[model samples]
Target chain A: MLNWIWIGLILAALLAAGVQDLGLVQLPGADAAVAEKGSRMAAVTEAAFDSAKTAVNIVIGLIGIMAMWLGLMRLADKAGLVQLLARALKPVLRRLFPDVPDGHPALGAMVMNIAANMLGLGNAATPLGLKAMEELDKLNPRKGTATNAMCTFLAINTAGFTLIPATVLGILAAAGSKTPHAIISTTLIASGVATITAIVTAKILERLPAFRLPPHDPPTADEPGAGKEATR
Target chain B: MRELLQAVATAVSSWAVPAMIGTILVAALVRRLPVYEEFVEGAKEGFQVGLRIIPFLVAMLVAMGMFRASGAIDVLKTIASPLLGAVGFPPDLLPMAIMRPLSGSGAQGLLAEIVKTFGPDSLLGRQAATMVGCSETTFYVLAVYFGSVAITRTRHAVVVGLTAELAGFITAIWVCRMVFA
Candidate 1:
C-alpha cells in the first residue's frame, strides 16, 4: 500500500511536471532571465572550479582522516576515551531517547553516526547507520508499525545534519563569497528546523492507528500486546 | 561536447581511479605497519565495504551515462533554468548540473568547458563550479547506498536525494546571487 502511495505521488509529480513542460503555466521571471544568463555563467564556472576544490579536498581529506580516526578510535577504546565520552554523555543520550533501553546497543552506533557526520564524512557514517539499524531491529517491540524511536532517528538522519558545514562552506568559498562562514547560522537554523520537523512527524505518525498494519510496517521482533490492537 | 567527454575520461582514469587505488595502497602500507595486528579486522572491514559499494557505483554511473546519452539532460536543464537564474546560477552551470548528477568527472568536464568558454572568474563559471563542488553525485550516492544496504526496495531515496540536490542547487544559486549579484 505504501509502495502504491509512493508510486502515485511520483506519478502525480511526473504528470504535473509534464503539464508544466507543456506550457500550462507561465515561466517564472527568474528562469527566463536565468536561461539568458547561462552564457555569462560560463565565465564563472571556471572560477567555481577552483572554489569547488575545497569541498572535494575536505571530502578526500576526510577519507584519509577517517582511517586514522577509526584506528585512533579503536586505540581510544583501549585507552578509555570512548568510555569517558560515553560516560559523560550517557545522561544526555538517555534523556533524549527515553523509551530506549538503557543498555541499548544502538547508543554506540547512533553516537558514531552523529560524530562521523560532524566530520563531513558521510561515507563514513554508513557503517554506523547500518549498525544502528541492526541494533534497533533487535529491540523493536512491534512486528508492525515503525516505532517512535525508529521514525525519529530516520527523521533526524533525513532532515540534515549540521555539525560539519564543510560542504556548504566549500561551495560558498568556491563561489568567491566573502561570507563563506555565513552558513554557520543557516546551518543551525535549517538543521534545527529539520530536526524538529522529523521529531514531530515521527511522533505524530507513531500515534496514527493505521500504522499498526503490515506492509506499511517496519519488520520487527514478536512483541506481546502490540498486535492485539490491530486484531481488535 | 568534446570537452565534456574528455573531462569524463580524465575523471574516470585520473581522479577517481587514482584516489581509489591510492587509498588502497595507503591501506596496504598501513597493513604493513607494525602498530597493531588487531586493527587488521577493522581495516578489512573497510575493504569489504569498498568492495560492496564498487558495483553499485559502476551501475549507477552507467545509468547516468545512459541519461546523458538519452538527451534527457537538456530537458532537465530547460526545466531548471529559470530557477537556476533566479538563484543567480549562470547559464553554464546548467550543464554542470546536468552532468554533475551523472558523474563527478563529467561535471568536471562541464566545469572545465565553462571555464574554457568563459573567463575563470566570471560569475556564472564560478557559480557552476561552486555548485559542482557543493553537491554529491546523485547516481553515485544512490549506487553506493543501495549497493551497500542490498535493498530491493529503494523507497523514496531517489526522490529525496534528488530533492536534496535541488536544495543544493538552489543554495548554490542563492549564494552566487548574494555574492555575485
Candidate 2:
C-alpha cells in the first residue's frame, strides 16, 4: 500500500511537471522568473542537455570497463582470491555483522558491496548487492520479511563508506568556486551521520512487529510476501 | 601546486576528518554496548562491501572526469534554464538538476560551473553548491544500495531525496535573496 501510494505520487508529479512545462497547465509564477533570467538560463539549459548526453556516453564506457573488471574478479575468485578474501573477512565481518553466520556467502557479497561504495562505484556496486541478496535468501530458507541482519545490512549500504569526497569537491572546483574543496567538511559530516542514523533506524524499525517477517509456518517456499516486492 | 595542496587538505579535512572522528566514536560506543555487536559486525562487513564496488566506482569516476573535461556540461546548463527557472532554480544549475538522478560528480561539475560563471560567493553559485551539499546522493544510493539489498520497496526514499534537493534549492535561494541580494 505504501509503495503503491508512492508510485502514484511519483507518476502524478512527473505528469504534472511535464504538462506544466508544455504550457498545458497555466502554473502560477512561471513566467516572471523565466522572463527575468531567460537568456542566461537558455544558455545553461542548452549546455546541460549536451553535457548530460556526453555524460551518459562516458558512463557507457565505464559500464563496459566495469563488466570486464567483474569478469576478471570472478576468475580471480576461481583461483581462490575470493576464498582468501572471504577467509580474511570472516572474523571482521563476524565482528561487524554478528547476526550473519561465519562462512555465510553473503559475507563475500557484503564486502563487495562496501568495497564498491568506498570507491564511489555505483555501477560496480550493483551486482554485489544482487548477489548478497541471493545469498541472504538462501540463508533465510523460509522467505518472509528479511531477517534483522538483512535489514541491518541494507541500512549500512544505504549509509555507505562514501570514500571519495574528492569527486564532489573536484566538481565544486570545476563549478568555478575559489573554494571548490569546501564540501570536504560537509560530505564527511553528512555521510557519516546519515550512516549512523540508518543503522539506528533500521535496528529500531526491525524490532517493530510490522517490519518483522511473519511466522514461517510449515516453512514453505512460496509464501505470501516472498516475491511481492513490485507491489507493496 | 598550492591549489592542489589546498584541495587535498580540504578533501581530507572535510571527508576523512569526519569519518575518522565519527567512526572512532561510533566504534567505541558500539563496542561497549551489547546490541552494538550486531551493528559492528554489519560495519565490518562494510569494508569488504566497499571493495566489491571499487570497479564500478572507478569506472563511474572516470566517466565523471571525462564529462567535466568535455565542455559538454556548459551546453546542458543553458538548455535547462527556462524549465528550471519555473521552479526558481537558475539555469546555471541545470546540470546539477539533471545529475541529481545520474551522478553526483556530474551535478558537482555543473555546480562548479555555476560558481565559475556567477562567482562562488555570488548568490547563484553559493546557493547552487549549498543545495548540492544539502541534497542526497540519489542514483548512487538507489542503484547500488537498494539494488544490492533487492529492496523493491524503496519506501519513497527516492522521492524524499529529490524533494529534499528541491527544498534545499528553494531555501538556498530564499536565504541568498535575504542575505546577499
Candidate 3:
C-alpha cells in the first residue's frame, strides 16, 4: 500500500527525470528544456532538500494551532463535553463504527474532528483527527495493523466534508472574483457525495475476503486454552 | 440567496474558533475543572505530536516534491488530455485535480495559477476552485494520521482515500458544469 506508493513515486520521478534529460520527452518550455536536459535529475535532488525543509516548517507552523485546539479539546474533555457530544452522536456513529464502544473517547475525538472539518477549520481538524487516531489506536487488537474503525475514520477524513471551503473562496476573492462564493453549493454537494462514497467503499472493502480479519484472534491465541482452538 | 449563504459562511468561519474555545473554557470553569492545568498538559502532548510527525512529513513530502519537480505531471497531463476531452473537462485543470490528493500547497499553487491564467469568473477557474474545495490532500492525511499512531500496515486506507478523491474531483467537475457552466 503505502510502501508501494512511496517507492513508485520515487521510481517514477527518477524515470521521468531521466527521460526528460535524454530528450525523449518534450518539455513545455522547449528552449529551457533544450538548455537544461542535464539538470532534470539535479532539480529532483534539490526538491528533496527543499521539501524536507518545507515539511519541518509545516509542522512548526502547526504547533501553535495544534496546541490551541488540543488545549481546548482537553478542557472540553475535562468538562465532560466530549462525552456529551459523543453520546449525542452515538446512534449515527454506532452504525458507522460498530466496533467502537459507546461513549468511547475516540467517538468524541472523531465527532470534534468532523465538526471542525465541516467548519473548514483545517487547523483544528488535523489535531483532532490525530487525537481521534490515538484514541482509536488504544482499542487496536493488533499493534500495527489498522482496524476497521481506523480505515473508516481515514476514509471520512479524506472525503473532507465541508459546509464552506474558506481557503478556496479566499483564493478566488484574492483573484478579484465578484462572485467568489458561487461555488459554495457546488463544493458542498461534491464533498457530500465524496464522503458518502468513501464510507460506503470502506465498508464494502472491509467485508471482502482479501481484507477480512484472520480467523485467529491473537490475544486469544496468546492465552493457551482461553478459547477453543480451531483446526486450520 | 448565494450572497446570504456566503455571508453566513464567512461569519461561521471567522467565529468558529473563538466560539468553540470560549465555550470549552467556560464549560470547564463552571464544572470546577482546572482548565489552565489541563490545557497546558494537553498542549505539551500536542507539541510531542507535532515533533513525531516530522519524519513522516519529510518522507511523504520529499517523494511527492521530487515527483512534482520531475515534470511527471506534465507528462501525465499530456497523456490524460484526450480522456479529459472525451468527458468535456478542461484539460488545463487536470494538474490541480491530480495534485489535490498529493500536496496541499502544490494544489493551492495550481489553483492560483489557474485563477490567474483564466479569469476567476471563467468556467475553468470556477471549476478548479470547486475541485480544490472538495478534495482533501489524501496522501498527507494518510501519512500524518497513520504516522502519528505508528501504524505501518494501512490495508485499504489508500485505496479508499484515492477513491474518495477521484469521486470528489469528478463530482466537482460535474457540479461546476451544472451550476456555473
Candidate 4:
C-alpha cells in the first residue's frame, strides 16, 4: 500500500508538472498563468529540496519535546501509574481485543499509548504504540501479518482522539487569534466521532470474508477459529 | 451552553499538559523513584527513535511537497471546491482536508498559511484548525506502526484509517459550523 502511494505521489507530481509545462493545463490563478515556461517545473524541483530539509528539521525539532514527554512517561511508568491506569481500563480493553489474553503486557502498553495520544503527546505515543505492537506480535502465529488486535489498536491511533490539540492551539495562538482555544470542543466532538467510527469499522472488517485472517493452528489458549469471531 | 463548553474546553486545553507533568513528577517523588535517572534513560531512546524516523519522514514529505508545488493540490482544490461548497464547507479548507491524512507537517504548513490568509478568527480559519485537529496522519501512522513490526499485509487497516479520517473531516466541518457560525 505504501509502495504504490509513494510512487503515485511522485508520478502524479511529474505528470501534472509536465502537463502544465506543455500548456495543456494552466493553474487557476492569474499570477500562475503569467509565469514562464520552465518556472512551474522549477518550483517542483525547489519543493523537493525544501521538503527534505523540512523533514529533517521537523525530526530534529521534535528531539527535545520527545525527550521531555518520554522522560515523563518513564517516570509515570516507574511510579506504577501507567500500570494502574492500564488496570483500570482492563475491562474495556478486554472487550475490544478478545484475542489477547486477560493479562497480556500488550494491554498495558496500549493503555499508555492511547493515554499519551489523548493528551496530545505525539512524542510519547509513537514509542508506546510500537511497544504495544511488538507485544501484540508475540501472540501472532503468522509472522509479518497483522493480527486483529493490532489492526484494532492501529485504528484507534489513526483516529487520533486528542483532548488538548496542543499543536493546533499553539499555531492559532502564534497567529494572534483572540480565541485560539475555541476549536477545542469542536475538535473533541469531531475526533470523538472519528475514533468511534474507526473502532466500529475495524471490528466489522475483521469479521468480513475478504479481510478475515486465514485459518491457522491455534497458538494461544483462548484462540477461537481464526476467521471466526469469538462468541462472548 | 455553547459558551460554557467553550470556556471549559479552553481551560482544560490550557492546563492539561502542565497538570499532567506536575502530577507525574509528584507521583514519582512519592514513589521514591529516581525520576532524573529514569527520565534520562528513557530520553536516550527518544533520540534514537527520532533519528530512526528520518528516512521515512523525508521520503513521505518530499513526495508530498513535490505534489503540492506542482500545483496538483491547487488544481484538485479548485475542482473540489464547488462540490464541497455546496455542502457548506469552506473551499479554503479543501487543501487541509486533502493533505491531512497524508502528511502532518504538510497539513500544519497549510493550516498556518490558511489561518494567515483568512485571519485566525475567520470562520474558514476556525474550520481548518478543527479539521486538522480532528484526525491523525493516517498514512504516517500506518507506515510507522506497521513498518515497526515488519508487517506488509495490512489488510483493511488502510481502509479503516481512511474511512475514519473521512468521517472526522466531515464532522469537523459540521461541528465548526454549528459552534462557530
Candidate 5:
C-alpha cells in the first residue's frame, strides 16, 4: 500500500496542477495561479529536486545521531540492560504484541524506541525503530509482507507519546511565547490518546481477513535456515 | 491545575535527556561492559543503516515536495476549512494538519508561520503548537521503517497509523481549545 499512496500523491499533484493550469479549477488564494503554467510546473519540478537534495542532506545529518544512539544501544545490549528494560516492559509489550516470543531482541528494541520517542528524542527513536523493525523481520514468515507484530509496532511508533516535545517548545520559544511549555500537557494528552487508538486499531485490523498475511512460501537457498529460525 | 501540569512538563523537558544518559552509563559501568568498544561497533552498523535509507528518503521527500509545491496542500486547506470550521477547529491550521502526515519540515515551517502570524500566545498559535507536538509524520515513518526492512506490502500499518494521526489531530485541537481558550 505504500506504493499506492506514493503513486496517488504524485498523480494527485499533477492533476491538481493540471486543473489549475487549464483554469478548470481556480483556487481563491493559490499563488501558483499567478505564475504562468509552464513556470508553475517548473517550480514544482524544482522543488522536487530540492527536496531530493534535502533528503540526502537529512540522511547525512542522521549519521552522527544514528551512530551515537546505536552505539549506546550496543553497549546497552552488551550490558544486558536492554533485556532488563524489555523484561520490565514485558506486561505492556506482551499485550501489544503477543506473537513475539518472550526475551526476543525485538522486544528490547521496541521498548527502547518507545522510550526515546516519549523523551522527544526523534533522532534516537528512528534508528532504534528501524532496528526493531529489522529484528521483527527476522521472525516474519513471509519475507516481503509486514507481519501483525510489525504493523502494531509501526502504529505505536508513528503515534508515539511525547512527554517533552522539545522541538515544538524550541519553536514556540523562538516565536516568543511567554509560556512556551504550556502545550506540553496538551501534547501528552493528545499523543497518549493517539497511541491508545493506534494500538486498538491495529489489533482489530490484524484480526480481519483482509489484512491477514498470505501463506508462507517455501524457504529459498538465500534464506538459509529461514524455517528453523522462524520457529525459534 | 493547569499551572501544576505545566510545571511538571517544564521539569521533565529540562532534565529528561541528562537523566536518561546518566542512567544508561551507570548501568553499563555496573555491568562491567566494554562500553566504548560496543559503542563503536554499533555506530558502524548505524552508519550503514543511514546509507541504506538514502534512496528511500529521496523517493519519499521528492514525492512529498512535489505534492506540496503543486499547491495541492493549499487546495486541500481551502476544501477542508469549511468542514473543519463547522466542527470548531480553526481553519487557519488546516495546512499544518494536512502537512503533518506528509512532511515534518513542511509542517514545522507552517507552524512557525502560524505562530508568527497569530502571535505565539494566541489561541490559533497554541493550537498549532500542540498539534505539531502531538504526532509524528505518518508517511515518513512508514517509509523509513518499512523501507529499511524492504517490506513491500504494508497491509494494515498505513490505515492504523493514519487513524492514530487523525485521533492525535482531533485531540490536539480539543485539548488546546479547552486549555487556551
Candidate 6:
C-alpha cells in the first residue's frame, strides 16, 4: 500500500514539475513567481535533499524525549504499574481483540502503547506498538499475512487519540498563538470520533469475505484450541 | 459553553505532562521499583528504537518534500478546493489534509506555514492545529510498525487508517468552526 503511495507521489511530483517547466499551468501566488529562476524539477530535488537532512535532525531531536518516556515506562513496567493500568483497561481491550487470549502479553503491550500515544509520546509509542505487533505476530497462523488483530491495532493507533498533542502545541506556541492550547478539546473530540470509527470499520471489514482469513491455515503453536478461540 | 470548554482545555494542556510524569513516579515509588536502573535500561532501548526509525523517516520525508516542492500539493489544492469548499472545509487547508496521512514532518511544516500565513489566532490556523493533533501519519506508522515485524501484507490497515484520517479532518473543521468562530 505504502509502496503504491510512494511511487504515486514521485510520479505526480515529476508530472507537476514537467507541467510547470512547459509553462502549461501557471499557479497563482508568490509560489508561481519563484519558478522563474530555475526549473521546478531542480527545486523539488533540492527540497527532497533538504528534507532528508531534516529527517535525520528530527530523529536526533526525538532521542531525548523518547529516552525520557521509555525510561519512565520501564520503571512503570518493573513496578507492575503497566500491568495495573492494563488490567484497568482489560474489559475494553478484550472486546476490541477477542482473538487475543486473556492475559496475553500483546494486550499489555498494546495498552502501554495506547497510553504512551495518548500522552503524545510518539517515539515511545512506536517501540511499544512494535513490541505489541511482534507479540500479535506470534499468534498468527499465516507466516506473512497480517491477522485481524493486527489490522485493528494498527487502525486504532493511526486514529491517534492524543490528549496533549504536544507537538502541535509547541508549533502553535512557536508561531505565537496567544492560546496555543485552545484546540485541545476539539482535538480530543475529533480524534475520539476517529478512533471509534477506525475500530468499527476494522471490525466490520474483517467480517467481510474479502478480508476474512483463509480457513486452511492452522494455528501452528500455542494452545491447540487457540485457533478456534480466534474464530469467535 | 465555548468558554467553559476552552477553560477546561487550558487546564488540561498545562497539567497533562506533569500529571503523567507524576503518576509514573508515584507508581514506581509505591511498587518499590528500581527507578534509576530501570530508566537507564529503557533509555537504551529507546535510543536503539530511535536509530531504527531513521531510515524510514528519511524515506518518507524525501517523498513528502518532492511532492510538496514539485507543486503537486498546489495542484491538488486547486483541484480539491471547490469540491471541499462545498463541504465547508477551507480550501487553503487541503495541502495539510492531504499530507497528514503521508508524513508527520510534512504536515507539521504545513501546519506551521498555515499558522504563519493566517496567524495562529485565525480560524484556519486553529483548524489546522486541531487537524494536526487529531490525525496520524498513516503511511509512516504503517512503514515503521509493520516493517519492524517484517509484515509485507498490510491488508485492511491502510483503508481503516485513511478512513480515520478523513474522519479527523472533517471533525477538525466542524469543531474548530464551532469553537473558534
Best by TM-score: 3
Candidate 6 lDDT score at position A222: 41
Error of 6 at A109 (Å): 2.3
What DockQ do the predictions score, one after another? Answer: 0.06, 0.08, 0.76, 0.57, 0.69, 0.58
Tell me which of candidates 1 and 4 scores higher on lDDT. 4
Candidate 1: regions farther than 4 A off: A1-232, B1-38, B47-55, B69-71, B78-91, B98-102
Which candidate achieves the best DockQ against the true structure?
3
Q: What is the DockQ of candidate 6?
A: 0.58
- Give the better candidate number (4 or 5) by DockQ: 5
The share of true interface contacts that also appear in candidate 1 amounts to 0.00
Steric clashes per prediction: 15, 53, 0, 0, 0, 0
Which 10 successive residues of model 4 chain B have the least lDDT summed? Answer: B5-14
Per-residue C-alpha lDDT of model 4 across residues A1-232, encoded as one tens digit per residue? 5678789998888887778777887666724533642466787898899989987897788777767766777787778776777678888988899998865667877987897788776766777786677678888866667899999999999999988788898999999999987888899899999999999999999999888887774466665556655443
**Predicted candidate 6 versus true structure: per-residue lDDT over A1-232, tens digit per residue:** 6668778988999998888778887778736535563788888888889989987897788778767766776776677766776677789988899998776767877987887788666656776787688679888867567899999999999999987788898999999989887888899999999999999999998888777777665546543443354431
Candidate 1 CAPRI level? incorrect
List model 6 lDDT by residue over B69-105, tens digit each: 7888888887788898887778999989888988787
For candidate 3, the per-residue lDDT at B58 reads 93
Tell me which residue pairs clash in candidate 4: none
lDDT of 5 by residue, A70-89 (tens): 88777777777778878888
Q: What is candidate 3's lDDT per residue for B1-181, written digit by digit as tens?
A: 7668778878988898889888898899999998889999888887888888899899999999999888888888888899989988789988887799999889999999999999999989988998888879999999899988888888899999999888888888888888777
Off by over 4 Å in 6: A30-37, A50-81, A173-178, A216-232, B1-58
Q: Which is superior by lDDT, 1 or 6?
A: 6
The most accurate candidate by lDDT is: 3
Second chain TM-score for model 5: 0.81
For model 5, the superposed segments whose C-alpha errors exceed 4 Å read A32-38, A218-232, B1-32, B87-89
- Tell me which of candidates 2 and 3 scores higher on DockQ: 3
Is 1 or 6 the stronger prediction by TM-score? 6
* Residue range A47-83, candidate 2, lDDT tens digits: 4455446544544554454443344334333344445
Candidate 2 ranges beyond 4 A from true positions: A18-66, A79-92, A121-123, A142-147, A217-232, B1-118, B121-140, B143-181
